[model samples]
Every structure is written in structure tokens, then in C-alpha cells.
Target: MSNIEIVDSNISTNSEKSCVFDSSINIDEISYNDFFSNYLIANKPCIIQSNATKNWPCKKDWIQNGAPNFTLLKQLFGDCTVPVADCNKRFYNSQDKDEMTINDYLNYWMDFRAQNYPTDSPLLYLKDWHCKKEHPKMSIYQVPKYFASDWLNEYYSGRTNLNDDYMFVYIGPKGSWTPFHADVFSSYSWSANIHGRKRWLIFPPGEENHLRDSFGKLNYDVLEDERIKNDNKSVKFYDIIQETGEIIFVPSGWHHQVWNLEDTISINHNWVNGCNINNMWLALKNELLSVMREIEDCKEMEDWSSHCQLMLKASHGMNYAQFYDFLSFIAEKRINSLVYKTPNLSFDTWIFGKNHNLFDLRQIKIILENFVEDAKDKSIYNLICKNDEVEMLLNKIELVFQSCK
Candidate 1:
């Protein structure tokens, strides 16, 4: 565990406050429009005021007095099994993960508490729980208006092809830390701390390029790596103390590490929208190319391209087809909105009004052009040609995009 101490408001001085909260933006400092134009569009990270999640129900249901409501949590969700990561040990690139019931996790947490919070390594942190999937009717928190333009969840939740969403709940005790990494698919993510403080070290987008060592391997822990600090003096980051109720808007490609300064619970959502869809496509292309290189000896193997896609999906949790489906899904919705002169009824994701819909459509068009060129270069051009619906969708998207312009 890192040696950073939690900033106590009563005991902390102005210097300590500046060190921890230099990156914070008061919630009232910016309206939703300012948030969209400044943070989301600019692809930057910021700690919004706790007021963003101040009114959330989880503050009441999940937190009792000043501590986590462990009793109620175990009562309602003890049966739900979640993957817990051992922070002290690394299994190659990531920590060792095991599945356990929420009940058992809560018990382990309580036992850790009873010991008076020892300086222990290897804290067990429950990483990602799709509790919304388990309890669909519960209202833990409403999505903040600034982040309501969440295309990723909107697509995953309504998909008939799969039952999944990126909404997640994270719970962990003090000293539990997550290693540095970018978000899945390089998408934007927002994490709201319902209770307890968190220490976050977030590096900007291209900082990752400097993080890799001579062997082209990234360090598992940025804080502990001497070479990373010595050799890459230019790499900068934001050290933020996210107090309880604060929501952090993490933009695409910003690699970050987080530690629970106390027993903590947070709601997180990984989302993609027109703003960062290009990053998503580029990530897929780069990952696919890397996978191809890994299995280059199998170039003569049957369906080698298909095998590469399968491996990509297995490793990255998504393939080009699924990504294309995501594009097509949003494209259809935006196209329908424009063609029928109808506003997007899904209020949570529709931003900037109808003209913003046009911008999204145009953004998709730009990516679609790159998608085709990449397919042809990869020798999988037939993947696009074989799908009649994809071709027609492309045509319709182009027409709508032009007409709207």
C-alpha cells in the first residue's frame, strides 16, 4: 500500500488541501453545458463537487452514519457473487481474482476492521459488480445530467443479442488499490464515490506512451517503479483526493490508479459517445494488429482472420463485429431521429438537442470511413462486403449525415 494519508478536513491545512484538491471543480462552477464543452469535449479529467452525487440514495442506503452500511448491504446482496482482486500480489499483468459471495466479502471486511486497520499488503477488493443486472428495480443513484450522454450503456442495455451493461459497483477496504490502466475500449468513465475517501493518480492521454519500458512493457505500479520516475521525468499526473460524494469524470485514454482511503463504495459507469468513439475504434484496430502479430505464424492456418478476431474478442471483450454492431445501433437511433423529425426519447443519452444528433451521425461517418479502409488493409474486406445490412446502413448514414449538414 502507498504511504499517502487520508486528508482529514479538521486537521488538514491549506497546503494539504492544495495538494489533494488542486484538480477539483465545484459542482456549481459549471453547468451541464460547461461540463460537456469543457471536460467531455476537451477529453480532460476533473473532480466535480460532491454535490453531483450528494443527493444519491446510496448515501443513505449504503452508508450508515459515517461508515458503510455493511449490515444492510449483506442483507440485500449477500448472495451476489463478485470477483475480488488481491492487491498485494500480481498474476502476471493483473492481480489474482477470485469469486466469492458478497456475504463472505463483507465478513472479511469486518474482520479487517476488527483488527484496527493493520498495515497489511494484499487487501481483497471487490472490483466490479453489475448489481443493476441482479436487482433491476433498485435505484441506487441517478445518472448525473452531465454524464447522461452515455451511449455505451444505452446500447448494451437494450441489445437483444446480449444481456449486459457497463454499470458497476465497487467496494473495498483501506489499502486496497487498483493498478494503473486505461478504461476498457478507451471509453470515458465516471466514478461516483457514495461513501469514503479515495486517492487517485490520473495521467493524461499520451502519458502512456512514456510509461512503457525498454522491453515495451508497462509497469504494474507507477508509484513503485524507479525507472519510470527516473527515465520519464516528463510524465505528469493529477493526485486527487476524492472525498465521499465526489464524482470523478475520467476521460478516454487517461490511465489511472485508485486506492480506497477507507472502507469505500462507488458507482462506476464506462461509457462511449460521439466524443470518444474515435479512440474506441483506434484501440480496436491497434489491439487487432497486436493479436495478429502474436499469431503471425498461423497466417497459413484456416480462417486465420476469424481466429484473430476470436482471440481479440476473448482478450479485449469485444471484436470488430460487436463494435460495428454498436456503431450501427446508435446510427439507427440517430438516423431515425433525423429522418422522422423526432427527438431522441431516451433522455439520459440525448445531448445538444437535434443538432448534436447530427454531430454524432457525422462522427460515426468519419469512423465508418476509417473502418472500411482498415478492413480492406487487414484483408478482411469481405467482412464488410458480405453483410448487406452493414452496407445499406453505411449508405443511409452517409445520406442522413449529408442532408442534416
Candidate 2:
């Protein structure tokens, strides 16, 4: 029903005048190829009109009278325990959160509503509740085609061994806010407001450096920092208001803080695809390197590099072994789609033509090669390539590329 112009995957958008957009681009129509080239691959952020989300089940089930229908949420999820954060206190990089049932959290919100949302009490905000994971049967929201090429969710979802996903449901009241931070692994994220409104201050890639203090530490709350007053010219930040039923795309490496302008319920996801797979790989490399630096003195110990990988996995939920497997998993899927065509993935790959599929394979092959090279650094060849599958998958992807050529 939507007219999606198939963009030539190799054609650069900068050369196409109609494909370029100003910061004020408001897309009332959802074009998969154009959205992929203009925003996703371009790494720019934009707000798609609410018409994009008009048919989502959340627009009907989650909203009531222009606000969240808390009573219905409790009835659906009261027994499930959720994480609640106190906005008044900041813990290290993120606010400390405690687990409570959905019912209790809703009661706290209702009590706040009864009190006219006074500032005196600590704001209890429910953040990052995996309601979709727990209630997969419930048709809450659909992953828009614009974000359907999500490797993070696809990988985690396919693994029965893993019990996590990037999909999250956020519910909070007015004044409840998130601290300044980038998405996990610097992945691109899109958030859709199911109900209520949100005020967001998003800083581009380098503006966060201007907000850092003399200690070289990034400020947790940019709003409370005094350097903000003196350093206006150096920082380029966008203060945008997200309305109910609208979706906002936050690109990779963009640090942002969000405040609820009213009681809000939203669906959010951090996703990785061919366009930003390199960013994820680099983020993992840097995170692992930081961990290795912390324990550099342990090099004298037996299997010191192995210990670093262990700590990396424990802290970041991923290490070189798993990261390799992630790439391989996606590589195999593209291989199957392009080579065998047995396991149907038409829902995601339908809009993506042969060139787009080849692009995915190319991205995965580069990362796999990097993984093998990086593993050889510490003579950890057994960590990846010696396993044989990485090499086989790389060659298989190359075969696909050659066939395309």
C-alpha cells in the first residue's frame, strides 16, 4: 500500500538532491529504501510522522485520553516484576534501580498523579521493562520496516541459550528522565511514544566532549552542569519534543538525555544492521581494550588475555567468542537467503533486493575478517578462526559476493 521506491544500494544519496534532508525533515510517508539510504545509512536522525504508527496496536491498547492507561497495563502485567529507578539519585553512570511488580509501580504512579506531581517526592520511574519478552503473545507494537533489519534482536532472539533482547518498554511520569549516555554498543535506536510526550536534548557525536569536565569524565546530567552556560558555541545540541504516536530515530554515537513532558509509555529498541555493523564491532573492541587496560598488570598471570575476555563478557554481555558467533549467525542467515533460499525471511528481506542483501554479506564478511585478524593478536587463534566455521562462513560470503559480481 505504501509506495517504496527501490533505491540503488550503491548510489550515494549526496548525489541525489531529492534524497537529502534538512534537520526539519518530517516524513509523512514511510519509504523503506529511501529511509534506509537517507537516514539509516546516512546516520542522520529524524522524526517520522505519527501516521507511521497509526496502525500499531499500542496506539489503541496503551493510550487512553491522551495519556497512559495504567489500569489496563496493571491488569495485563501486575504479577510481573519490573525495574524501577529513582530519578533523584544518580549511581555511577546510571540510576540505581530496584525490582517491583508492575502493580506496585503503577500504584506509585497513581499516587504521584493524586499528589499533582509534586517535586518534593523522589520520582520512581519504571525503565527498560522487557514486557515484550515476557509477553511475546501480546500484540503490543510492531517493529516498523524502517528498523526491521535489526541484527541485535534477531541474533538474541534466535539463541535459545540467551535470555535477553534489545526491545524494551519504558513507562514513566512527568519529570522522570534518563541520564546522558549513548546506546549500548553505539547501536542506532528508535523510540516510539505509545502515549504522552517526551522532551529530548540530543548532542551530536563530538558535542559530548564539550560537556566533559576537567577530570575528562562525561557529565551524567548535562542540564546540571555549569560548563553548559559558558560553552554554548562548542556544543550543538537539538532540543526536540516527541509527541504521542510519533517515533524518533537516534543514530549511533549520539549522546542524549530524555525527560517525560507528561506521563509516558513508549516502545524502544537498539538495533544493529549492515549500515552500522562496523560501529558495533569497534565499540566492542574499545570496550574490551578498556577492560584489558584495567588489568594490564595481570599479563604476568597465566592466560591473562583469556581473563580479559572473561571480564569483558561478564561486564558487557559480549566478548570476542560471542561477537564472532553474532557475525557468523547473521552471515549464515544472509548466506541461506542468498544461496539456499530455504528459510524464508521475506518479512525483512522483501524490500531489500539482491544488492542490499549483498551489502549485508559484505558488511558481515569485513567484520569476520577483522575478527580473525584481531584474534591472532594474542595468539588466540583458537578463539575464532581455528574453530573453522568463521573461515567457512567468510568464504561462503565471498562466494556470494563473487556471484553477485
Candidate 3:
């Protein structure tokens, strides 16, 4: 990449003090009311001065042997450039193999690096290369459970149920150099750097113009490049270099760009609690709005009625599942037409084109309002609708037009 570096002393310190965490400083040590009120619920980012896997026996006893452990992890991780490995026939060997340690191995694979590992090596390119099955000894999702049992017991005392919408991402070196953008997913996230270091540049949401009408989606890469050139103007940015045993909480919709500074390992959990339910609902509403636009677009086409009739005939006597698949295909065509277009009309102008008059804003509003209300009340909507409301609405509108014909 991009050699843009923005450092924030608010999050970074050169203290040589080693932060140690054990059962004594578990989640119970911090009061839930205080923690949630002051930190977690507010979407404020904090460094939990504790080890994520302090209670795990494997992590405590794991040795940094250069052969079997390193060899096995390499086999599991595959080849990647940031980690710098060469293929020795079917197997791959790292140039830094001799310097492998527990910290180094953990750092190398934990950051987003594994995904960016050079694909040339057969050992790395296999689909199942990095796949790890859940086992009694090594349960992937159970890491949170272990933390709850050991550290978070006190803090989780009042919170009866924890939402499972969170994601656990382990990013390593060689991982994709993420562009500056906010997450479209409707949840806040907690990122813990278990090993190595990462540099982060963050900006508050809504501060930057998305420029989507020109580029379809937000052009984060271009935004990042521009931000770097104008850095002297004191634009909002934070550079975080988290070492082993630290956690950083990132709120939803905050624009952030992260790069692995070295062989790094970090786990991120994206979750939503009761307080953030409104944000999630708004995200859903945006999806519905997009769908309504597509439905309107499909209705404006000259052959719209005929196309819908043909599709309906194709789905005649088919099961609900088959009908849905066919409908999805129709929806995809409308969405694709919107996304990939000539330079003649911009996305916003194209969306408001004269051809979109057939469905009318009133009808589009009704469909969108109905979908959002239904989603909030019954929590039952088509999967395609949940994933992308615009496509589903377009397909459903086509079906309605076909019925009228």
C-alpha cells in the first residue's frame, strides 16, 4: 500500500510496563452498570487491560518450537507475501521460518494477513487449507464463553442474554489493506489485539461525503488517498498500535482504515445491544429504501409486464423455493442494471429518471413502509429482502404486474 500514517497519542503510549491479566481482573472486577453506562453502551472504544485467553491452558503452555508447531501452522495458514514464504514443491517454507516464535506465529496469522498470503503455493491455495473444525479441545466460538466463565462472570451478572450477532475476526499480516470506510453491517464492534501491532486511522461517521452517485458504492480507496494529502489540516484520525492482550471498541458507522504494522493477530467482535437497536432498524430502513427504488425502475421498462408474465409462466407449478429463485434472478437483473451503467447518467440522476414514473413515489413509499413495519413487528421477511430489499421489492412488483396482465 498506501504509506499514510496518522498517529494518535490518545491511544498510543511508549510505556514499557507489561500489563498482566488474570482471574482477579476478570469482567466481574468491572461493574456492568458502570461499564455499560460509561463505556460499552456509549459505543466508546477502550483497551481492556487483560489477556483474552488468560484462562486457556493451550495458550499458556504453548511453546515456540521451530519445527512441528511452526510447520503445522504454516501448513494450516498457507503461503502469503507479507509473511514472505516460498513454495518448496507442494509445501511452502517461510523466509522468516528460523525466527518463528509463539508471539510471531500468533501475530502472523491473527491479523488479516492469512487471506493475503501469496496464493502461488499449493499448500496455501487449497480451499480447506485454513479451515479449522470445531472440536471439544479447540472450539472456535467458545473463546468468548471461556472469557465469560473466567473474566466476564461479574460484569455479565445482570445481562442475562448476550446477542450472538457479533463476529469474531482474526486479522493477521498480509491481510487486505482495508480502505477507509464505515461498515454497512448494523452493529458496533470490539477489536482485541492479542498479538503484534496494527495502525488505525478513524473518522467520525457522516463527516465525509460518500460520493456514491458517481462510483456506485463509496470510493473509500480514493477518500483514503485524499485524506493523506490533506493531513496537516487536522482531519479526524486515530493511529492505534495494539500489542498482545489489549482490546479496542469501535462504534458502528465510524469510518476506519486499518493496516497490519507487522505480523499481527487481532480478534474483532461486532455486536448490538438494546441501546443500539435503533441504529440497526435504521440500517434496515435504508435497505428497504434501496429496494423500493429498484421496484420503481423495473415498473418503468416498456416490456416490464411481458417480462413478468414470462417469468411467472416459467415458475408455474413450481414450489415456493423455485419461485423465489426465479424471482431473485429478475431482481438481480434490475439491481445489476442500476449498479453497472454507462457514464451517460449518474446513479442519483438515473434513479430519478423519467422511466421510473410507473411505480410512483407513493406506491414505492407504501411498499417500503410495509416492509420495514413488517420486519420490526413479525421479524419475518424474504431472505433476499433481508439481504437486499431493493431486489426483493422489484421481483415482487414484477409479480404484481404479471398478475394484473
Q: Which regions of candidate 1 are displaced past 4 Å?
A: 1-22, 119-122, 227-233, 341-352, 402-405
User: Which lDDT value does model 3 have at 123?
Assistant: 20
The Cα error of candidate 2 at residue 381, in Å, is 2.4
lDDT of candidate 2 over 1-405, digit per residue (tens): 222233564544232323222334455565687788778778788887777778888789767877667788778898999989999888997898898899898888999999999989979889888878898788877677788778898888888589898889898989999999999988999999878899888887788998777999888889777555454655777778998878999988889999999988888999998888888899888888899889988788998878988999988878888998888888777777667664435323434456566677777777888888887786777854565778887777778877767
Tens digit of lDDT per residue, candidate 3, span 313-358?
Answer: 3433222232234333333333333344322121112221222222
Tell me how candidate 1 scores on lDDT: 0.79
Sort all candidates by lDDT, best to worst: 2, 1, 3
lDDT over C-alpha atoms for residue 173 of model 1: 92
Q: On TM-score, who's better, 1 or 3?
A: 1
Alpha-carbon shift of residue 339 in model 1 (angstroms): 2.2
TM-score of each: 0.89, 0.92, 0.48
Alpha-carbon deviation at 275 in model 2, angstroms: 0.4
Q: Identify the candidate with maximal TM-score.
A: 2
